[model samples]
Target chain A: MNYRIWEGKSGDSLNSENQKCTSRCGMTSSRPGMARRSFLRGTAAGIGGMAAMAAALSPLRELEAGAFNSVEEMLQKHYKEMTPDDMERALARIRRQVEQRYHVRPEIRDIKPVEGVEFAYALNLSRCIGCRKCVHACVAENNQSREPEIQYIRVLEMPRGTLNIEQGNHHYDRPTVPDDKHFYLPVQCHQCANPPCVKVCPVEATWKEPDGIVVVDYDWCIGCRYCEAACPYWARRFNFATPKIPKGALNPNMAYLSNRPRPRGVMEKCHFCLHRTRQGLMPACEEVCPTGARKFGNVLDPRSPVSEILRTKRVFVLKEDAGTLPRFFYYFDERYPRNTGGEAPTWTGPEEFPHG
Target chain B: MGMILAGLSAIMPNLDSSRQNEFDGAQPGLEELAHPHAEPVDPHIPGGALWAMVGFAALAFYFVSQPALPEMPLAATPVVQASEIAPGKRRDPIKEPPRIRVGAFTYGCNECHSLFLSAPERQGPLAQHTHIKLDHGLNARCFNCHDRFDREKLVLRDGSLIGYDQVPTLCSQCHGTTFRDWERGMHGKDLGSWDLSSPRHVRLECHECHDPHAPAYPPIVPLPAPNTMRMGTPVHLAHEHKPEAGNPLAPWWMHVAGGDGAAHGPGDAHEQTTHHTDGKTESAPSTHKEGGGQ
Candidate 1:
C-alpha cells in the first residue's frame, strides 16, 4: 500500500537489486520507477507508431465492402475436408453474395463427380475449321471476365507441314478459316491424370476430382501462382484485377468448383464444364462447335463416341513428352479436307471396297 | 604526326613532355594512326559542350521513345465485308424440305413433274427450273438422284425410292465412311447431351449440315479473334505492318524462308486433284484412270 513512498526513498538501491532479481526470474524490465519526462516521451512514441499504422492501412478503407470475405469463409475447411453441412452453409452464403452483387438469384450448386464416369474429350482435326465459336460460347456459359478477357480455349492455326505448336499462330484474323494451308488446334485444360498444377499447389486448394477434373477451391487459394507456372499447356489464368463481367452476360447456372464467379487473385482453368457434365449435359464448347469437331463422353463407357474414337482412330494427346496423360485427345480421320479434291478412296465406293 | 603533336602540345599545356616523348619514340606507325590532313583534337571545347551533348542525347531518346508519328493512315485494305461472309445456318429440326410455289399455292414436286413425261436426259438449262444449278461434280444429272417415276422421292443407287428424310441412304452410296461416322455420332453435330441415358440427345442428319445439291460445307466468317490482356490489335488495326514484312498471319516457316515457295502450295495440288477426280468420275468405265494418270 505504501510501496510508492518506499520506492521513492530506495529508488537507486532497489534498481540494482531488482535488475539482478529480474534477470534471474527472466522478466524483461527492472526499472523501479518511471521518470516524468521518459514516460511522456514513451507515450508520444507509442501514439506516433499507432498513427503510422493507421495511415499505412488507410487504402483498405476504399475496398468494396461487398467483396470482402466473411469470417465463416475465411475460416472454411478445404474442399476435400468439407462435410455436407459445411458445403450447404457455404453455398447459402455464396447465393446471398451473388444476389447482392448481381441482382440475380443464381442457381448455384455444389455439383459432385458422378461415380464410374471418367470424362474424355476428342477433337477431329480434319473437320475443325478454326472458327472460334467454342471460345466465345464458353465465355458466355462460364461467366468469365470480358474486359480483361479471360479465354479458356486458344485455337491455334497450325501449318499443314508441321505440328509444332510454337510455330502456330494465335492471332490469325482471316475472314474465313481453315485457311487451306493450316489446320486448327484448340487447346484447353487437358484434365491430366497426372496434373502438374495440382502437384505444385502450395495449399491443397486445387486437386483432381474422382472423375479426373482438376478443380480449384477459390476460397482456399492463397494466390501464389505456382500452379500457373506448372501448367505446360498455358491453361491456367490468374485474375489480376477484380473480374469485370457484364451484369446481363452473367451466367446464373453456377457450380462451386466449375463456373462460379471467381474472386480476384485466384487461379482458374477449364474444368470440363463440370457444372453441366455432372448433370448429364454436354459442355458448352462441345455443344457449340458448328463442325461437330469436339466430342466429349464417358471414356469408361465402351459405346460412347469418345471410346469409339479412341478404339478406331489413331488418337494422340498433346505434350505426351510431359507425361501429363491428358484426357483430351486429337485425331485425324483418313479423309481429305472437305471441298478439297484430294479425297482418299478409302471407303468412297465399290471400287475401293469391291465386296460392297 | 609532328604537326598534330605540336598543335596538341600548344593547346594542352598540361600534357606531360615525357608522355609526348614516349609516344614519339614507342610508336613507329604513328603517322597511320593520325589522319594526315585532319585537325588536331580541340582541348578548348566549349564550357557548354557537355551540356549540349547531354541535351542532344535526351532529345534523341525522346524522339526514339515516342511512338512513330501515327503514319498517314493509308486507305484500309478492302477486307471481305463482314456482311458478305456467310453466317452459317443450322437446320431447324421441325422445318420441312423445299416446296414449289404455283400462283399463291405451294405444290409438291409430284404435282408438276407427274403432269408431264420429261426427257430422261437433261436437254438444256430448263426454263422452269432455272434456279437449280446442277453442280454436284459428276453427279450433275437430275435423274442421278431424283426418282423419275416417283417425283416426290429420291432414287438410291439400287433404284429404291426413299423419302427426303432418307437422304443419308442415298449419300452413303458414295460417302460410305462419312455415313458410318455420322451413324456413330463422330462426324456431324450432336446436340443436347452426351449421356446416352438422357433422352434429349439428337444427331443431325447428313443434309442437316450439308446442302445435298452441293454436299460441301460452305466457308463461313469466323468469330472475332481474342484480344486477351489487350495484347492483340483489332483485325482492322492489323494492317500496321507493311506487306513486305511477310504476312504476320503466315506460318513461322514462311517468315524464315521468306516466301510461300518454301512449302508445297496446297492450292496447286487441290486444283490438279479436282481435275483428275472429275475426269475419272466422268469416264466411269475407265476403272484404272486415276492409277494410270498417277
Candidate 2:
C-alpha cells in the first residue's frame, strides 16, 4: 500500500498495481522514519494550511485535492453536531460555489434564529384560482428530487360551481385546473395560531416565536415526525431520505425564511416566503401571481393593504369557529361565473348568494 | 268737627283697599284666562297626584318600547349522537307535533322553535284537510304561513310580532339543505367566494325548505342517497390513515404470514394469512389464547 517510495521514481520503474494503490489512498511509500518529524510538524499546523501547500506542490492526488478537502469537511460535522459558526462557514463556502457555478450573486441572508417568533401561514381559499404556478414555482425553488417528482405546494383542483372542500384533489394531473363543476381552491398550511406541532415536539427543537412564526431547528430535530401528525393542516413534511439537488440548479439566494438547504430526516413547510417578506418584499407567489389574488401585509398596521381589505371588504377567516384566529382572510364575490364541467348543478338565485 | 276729619281719613284708605279686592274677586274676562277650567291655584304644589300619573305613564311607555325578555330560546339541544344509535331501530322521524289546543305540543318541539307564542303550527285551519293533503299536516301555524325572517327581531313571547324581511333560519332545523350546504360551504355568505368588482351575495332563510310549523326536510328529491361512511376513504378522509413514517414498531403488526417478510402487504402495512409462494396455509394463531386477553 505504501507508494511514497515510488512517487519520485520513474513511472516505468513502478508497477501498475503500486500506481493504482497510490492513486486510491493518496498515500505514498516513503521513508516513514525520515518523514515522521515532518509529518508531525504538518499535523501540528492546521489541515487547511497543509492542504493549500499540498495542492500546489504535491504530485499525489492533484486531481482529488479539492474533492478531498470538501469530503473531509463534510465528514467532520454530523449535521446535528454543527455549531452556528460551522453553519456560517458552510453557508459561505456554498455561496462561493454557487456564485462560481451559476453566475448568480445570491442575496444570502442568514436568518437569525428568532428567539420567540412562531412562523405560520394561511391560504385565502376564496382567492385561489387553481393555478399550478405555486406548485411549479415551489418545485423549482425548493430543488426537489426527480422521479416521483416532489414539491411543497400542491395547488388542489377543487370542484367548480361549488365550495365543497371534500371534492378537491391534490393528486391532479397535467393541465391542472378547477374542475368544471367545482370552484378552484388552493389550499396550503393553515399555520394555526395555536400550533399543535410545537406542542408535540419531543425535543423543544421546533417552537413558535413572538412574531407568530413556527420553525424547526434542523440540527436539533430527531426526525420523529410527531410535529407532522400533531398538525391539523398537514403543513409539516419529513425528509425520509437524503435530498438530491443538482449543484448547478441549487438556489444560492437562501434565507432562513424561504429556502434553506435542508438536511435529511427533518420536517419543513412554507415559511411564508419569510426570506423575501422579512426584507420588505412580497412573497414569490404574490410576485408571480396572475390574478392579483394573493395579498400579504402586517395585520397590526391598520393602514396596510391587508388591514384595509379586512376593514372595508367582507372578509372572513376559514374555520373561525375552531378559534384558530388565522391571519389569512377571504372576500367572496356574488357574481362569479360557474364552471359547469362536473355533475353538480349550479343553482342560480337572487344576487345574494356568495360564490366560493 | 275734628273727630269727623280723622274718621274721613281712615275711611279713604279703607275705601282704596276695598276697591282692589273687588277688582281681583270679579269673574275674569276671557282675555285673562284662556278657558274657565284653567282655574288659578297655588304654584307651590310639589309633585301632585296628576304629575305622578304622567311620570308613571312615561316610564311605562319606555318599558313597553323594548320587548319583554328575549323571545327566542337560548338553550342548546343535546347533540344528537349517531354513533351510539343502533342501525335498524326506526326512530320517529323528527317532526314538530300538531298543536290543536293550549297544550298540544308536549314533545319539546319548542326546543327547536324557541319562540313559544306564535309557533309556526297555528297559522291556518287543519280541520278541513287530511294529513296527506296538507303535506303531512305541517302548514297549520303562524310561522308556517310566514316565510321570510330576520334573526335580529324574533316573534315575541306575547302575541305581538315583527315582520322578518330575510328568510328565517327555521327551515335549517329539519331541511338540512343549508346545513349540508354549510358543511360543503355553499350556503353562507363570505367575501372570499366572490369577485370584488360585483360583490353582493344572497342571504338565505331557514324557511326556504320546511313549512315552518311542520319543519320537515322538503321531499324535493326522489330519494335520499345511500350513505357511504368509510373511515380513511379518500372522499371522506384522504391520506389520513397513514401510519407514522419509519417507525420500527409498525413492522410488528405488519409482519407477513408464517413469519416470512418477503411476501409483504400493500401500503406499508399488510394483513396476510397464507403464504402464496409455496402454497402453504399458515397455522392460525390459537383464537382462544390470543383473542382473549387475561
Candidate 3:
C-alpha cells in the first residue's frame, strides 16, 4: 500500500497534497511515502544515540555519585504506587545512603496515619512569643535546606494593632516575644481540608493524608512549581539546587514521604512530623515551644486538648474567604490586657487577627 | 476461571496473621485489593476503609446512646524532647529551684542560715547572699519564701512548708491566674503526646523560666534571623514605596541618606524624635538606618 506523509508547512496550497515529488530519488509521490519502518528506525537510532552518549558519560556520573542518586530518585515511584517489596527496597536504599553519606544510622520510615486519628493543630496567638524556637525545631526535625533557608514556620511580628500578615515580620530578632507594642503570629502549613496545593499539583505528588497532613513525595515531584504558586499561605518550598545539609546536623530521624533528603528540583512542605506523630509523639515545634501556644491532637477525640481548644476558644482560620477549609486554627485569649500608648488594641473579636 | 479465582483466594491465607509489615502505618488492606491505582485515594477511607467506617458508626451510636458521661484524661502526655542543646549539653541554669554552689561544694539553706541567722539578721545584711536582690513585686522578705524554722523548705503565708518541687504552689498564693493557666498547659512550656490516652505531660516548673530572686526574665540574645528565600526578610515596612509613584530616578546618594521614602517631613536629622524610638540618645537617621534594625 502506498501512503504519503503530509508535511504541513506555511504557504502550502491545499491542492499541494496531490502534487508529485520532484526529487531525483525513486520516490515519486505527492508529499512523500515516509515509510513507517524508516520513521521507526530513525526514532530508535535517535533514542539509542542519546542513550549511548549518556552512557559514555557514565564515568562522570560515577565520579559525582549524586548523579546516580538523582537518576535512581527520578525512577522511583510515588508513595501510593509503591508495593511492599518496592517500599522495602526503597527503605534499604535510603538507609544505605544515610550510612554512606552521613555516617549515621537513620530510622527513616514511611510512617502511616493512626487509626481513629484526625490531627488538628491550634496556635494561641496571644501565647506565641516569636522566639523562633519552633521554627528552628522544625528545620532540625524535617531536614529542611539550611543555606538558602527553607523555614516552614514564619513567626510574623505584627505591630500592636494590625491584622495585616503582609506587615508581619518573620525576621524580628528579639530577646522575648509578646513585645508590649507587637504581637507574634507564626504561620505554617494549614493542611487544609481542600488544599489548593494538592489540587494544582501536576504530578499528583502531594496529597492530604488520613490524619489531615498534606505530604509531598519529593521523588515524584517534577518541580513545575504549580503547587508553590497555588499555595495561599506560601507553605510549599522548592529545592532550587541540591539541598545542602551538614552530615552531622542531618536529623537521623526521617520519613520517606516527608523529611528524607530530597534531590534537587523537588517540592517539600510541612507534614506535621508524620514519623513522630504516627508513633504517638508530638511534632518537633510543639515539643520545643517555650510557651505552650501550639496545641495538636486528634480532632476525632473529643477529650483531646485540640478539640477542647476548638470548642472553648473563638477560633479563626487565615483567609476564610479562600475556602481552603484550613485544619489549623489561630485563636486569641479573652484577656489581652497589655495595651500601649493611649489608643486601645483593635481586637474587635477573638477570631479576628490583630487589626489596626 | 474457577482455578484463577481459587488461586487469588489462596494468596490471602495470611488474612488472620495480623500482618504488621505495612509501610509507616498505612493499612495492609491495600495489598488485598484486586486493583491498585496510583491516584490519590479518599484518605478518609484508606485500606480496610469499609470496616473502619462500620466500626466508627458503631462507636458513634454507642457513645450517643450511653447516659454515662465520657471520661476525660487528667492530662495528655507531652512527648518530651531535648530543647536547645541535647539533654547532656544544656547548662539548664535552674531545672526547678535555684541552688548556690561554691568551689566543689553545693549548699542548702542550712549550710549558712543556722548560725545566728534569725529573721532579725536579714535586715542587718550578711557576709553571703549579698548578690541576691529580691525584686519580685514587693513580697520580698527573706522569710516570705524561705522557711524560717526549716532551712530547706519554702514558707507559705499560713506557715506551711513546701519543697522546691512544690514552689508553684507557694507562688500560686499571689499569682493565681498564671498558676491556674500553667496547670492547664497554657502559661508555660510543656512537652509530650497530644493524645488523650498518653500519660500525663511534663510541665516546666515555674523557676525553669523565671529567676527565683529577680522573677523577671532578662532580655537574652535572639535566634538567627530567617532568610525566607523568595519572601526575603520580615522587616516591618514603614511604607510601601512604589518606584513608579515615587522618584524612581532619585540620586543614589539620597537613598544612603534615606530615599524619597514617603517624602520625608524635612530631612532634619536632629528633630526626628521618631527613634530614640530605640532607647539610644544620639540623633539617629543621620548615620545608621540598617544597623539600627538589627
Candidate 4:
C-alpha cells in the first residue's frame, strides 16, 4: 500500500458517507490499549462486497483499534505534507465534530493561509491598568484550554518600587492584587521587532507575519517548546494537555489572524485578539478598560490615538535599554506628584487592582 | 413805744436761732450747724443749679451712646496675626456675622452676593423667596446665601447691596469645572445661538441642578440599549457560482461560503466582495494579531 497516497488523500478521501468509519479508524491507531475493533455499520453489498468482507474479516479491526493513542497525533499533521485532500479531510472532521459537539451544524472551510500581509502591533501600556479583563477576554476569544495551569495572558504584577519585570510573577494565588506593596504592570507578548522565538524554532514552524504578528503554523509545530524557552517575556505557552472551553462561553466570531480553536500539543501565545482587530473593531481588552487606559489604533495613521500618544508623550518601551524596539511603550505622568511628598496621590491606583 | 417794738422783733429772731442750735446739739456732727458759712437766703432754689443740671445731662448722654459703640476695636487688625496689622487692611472679622450663622433677624447684605461657609445649598432660600425655607428656614437666614455684608464698608445705609458679577466666584467655589466649562463656552445654554457674530454669552447660575457644596454628577454610563441594528438591509442574497454535482439547485458558493449562503453567498463575486473565494482577488488578510493582546 502506498503511504504517500494515504497521506495525499488524507484531507479529501472520505465522503460524508464514509466519514464516521474513517474517523473511527483514524482514532483507533493513536490509542495503543484500545482494541482495534472497527465498527462497520454499513450495508455489505456496497464496495464490490468481497473487499468489504475482507476488510471486515481481517485483523483490520485490531489495527484500527490501535490507531490513536492520542487524539492530537491522530488529528494534526505537518502543513508541508498536507495536500488539498488532507485539508479537505481535516475540514470534514472539524465539521463532524462541530455537529456532534454543538447540536448546530456549522459550515467548515479549509482556509487558504494568506500571504504577504505584514502584521505589526502597538500597545499603549500607559493606558493599561491591571484589570485582568484582557485575560478572560483572551480565553473566551481563543477557545484556549481552561485548565488552571494554562493562561494566555500572563499578567505580570510589578510593584511600584521595582522596575525589573522579570522578578514580578503572576503565579501568586492569594488574590488579584497583593496589597499596597505593588502596582500592577501586566506584561504579555511584546511582539518584538526581532523575535528570539522565531530564531530558535528548529522547524520553520512559526514565522513572523507581515503585520508584525508571530504566528505558529499549528501543523508544522512539533510541540518541542523551543520557542517558549527562547522567549524573554515568557510569552509562549506549550499545550501539553487537551483543550476544553465550555460550549456556552465560546466566542463564535473567530478569525484566522486570531487563530481558531486549537487542539492540544501545539504552542499558543497572545495573538492580540486577531479575530476582532482584523475586523476593524477594538480588542476586548480595550473595550473593557474602565479607565480608558488601553488605547489601540493604527500606528501608521498620525490621527490615530496610539500614534498621537507616541508623538506627544515621553513614552519608553520596556527594556528599550536592550534595543528590542518593543512595540509596547509606557509613559509616566511626570507632573504626577508622588504621594511621598505631601499626602498620597489621590489615585489609589485603581482600588480593585490591589495586587502589585 | 418804738424801742419796745424793735426789741420785740429782734428778740423774737434771736429766740428762734437759739432753739435750732439746741436741737442740732442733741445729734452733734450729724446735725447741720446754723452758721454764716451755711447761709442760704432763697428757700425755693440756688442760682448754681444751672451748672449742676449741665453735669447731670453729660452723664446721661454717655449712658445712652454705649449701645452704638462698635464691639471690635476702631482700628483693623491683621487676620493672620492681629499684632502685625498691614496697611489698607480690610477689618474683616472671621466671626459669624449676624444672619451669617444659623439665624439672623434681618438678612445680612453679604449672604448670596459672596462666597461663604454656609454651603452652596443654603444659598437658595435667600435667592428666590426673600425668606429662608423651613428645612433651611430656622437657622439658614438670608446672609447664609448673601454672605457679602457691606456694613463695615458703610456702602449701604441699609446694607442691601447684593454684589453682582461676584456670583461666578461664589458659584465657582465648588462647581469649579462646570463654571469653567460654562465660561469657556464648552457647556451651558447657548444664548448666542442665533447671533454667532457676538461672543457675548450668558450662563445660568451654578445652582441650576447641583448645589455647589456637594457638587457631583452621576457616573458615566453609555446608553444601555443594544446598538440599533446596522441601518441597512439585514440579509443580501448573492450566489457566486453554479454547482458541478451534489445538488443542482444548491450553488457551490453556498457550500464554499459555509452554510447561511443567503447571508454570505452573494451571486456575483465581481460585484460583491463580502465572501470572495479567490484569495488573490480577495482583500489582503491582516498580518498583525487583531488586538495587541498578549
TM-score leader: 1
> Mind giving the per-residue lDDT tens digits that candidate 4 earns over B1-294?
234334333343344454443322111110122332343211111223323333434444444444432232111211122111111111222233345445555566455545543332432335444442334212233343443334322122233343433445555544465465445432232221111223432233444423322332212321111010111111111122321112223445645554332423222221212333443343211111111122
**Ten-residue region with minimum lDDT total, candidate 4 chain B:** B223-232
Per-candidate TM-score against the hidden true structure: 0.68, 0.39, 0.63, 0.42
Tell me the DockQ of each model, to 2 decimals: 0.12, 0.00, 0.10, 0.00
Top DockQ prediction, candidate number: 1
* lDDT ranking from best candidate downward: 1, 3, 4, 2
What is candidate 3's lDDT per residue for A259-292, written digit by digit as tens? Answer: 8887767898889888888888888888877656
RMSD of 2: 45.3
Ranking 2 against 4 by TM-score, winner: 4
**Model 1 spans > 4 angstroms off:** A1-62, A338-356, B1-89, B93-99, B104-106, B123-126, B229-238, B241-294
Writing each residue's lDDT as its tens digit, candidate 1 over A126-195 gives 9999888888888878888775678888887766867776555565666566678778899999999999
Residue-by-residue lDDT tens digits, candidate 4, A1-356:
11111232344442331354344533222211211111010111122233323433443333332233346446666655677787677656655554555444543443332343323333433334454555555555566665423455555444456566543434222222223344446666777788888889998887766556667776567798999877766677777555655656455554433545665578888865655554455555544433334555456555444565576667776766555566666655433212222332233233232111
Quote fnat for model 2. Answer: 0.00
TM-score of chain B of each: 0.48, 0.20, 0.46, 0.22
Residue B203, candidate 4: Cα error in Å is 27
- The DockQ of predicted model 4 stands at 0.00
On DockQ, the stronger of 3 and 4 is 3
Query: Which CAPRI category fits model 4?
Result: incorrect
Predicted complex 3: CAPRI docking category: incorrect
Query: Which CAPRI category fits model 2?
Result: incorrect
Give candidate 2 regions above 4 Å deviation: A1-90, A93-107, A112-127, A146-148, A160-164, A174-179, A316-323, A337-356, B1-294
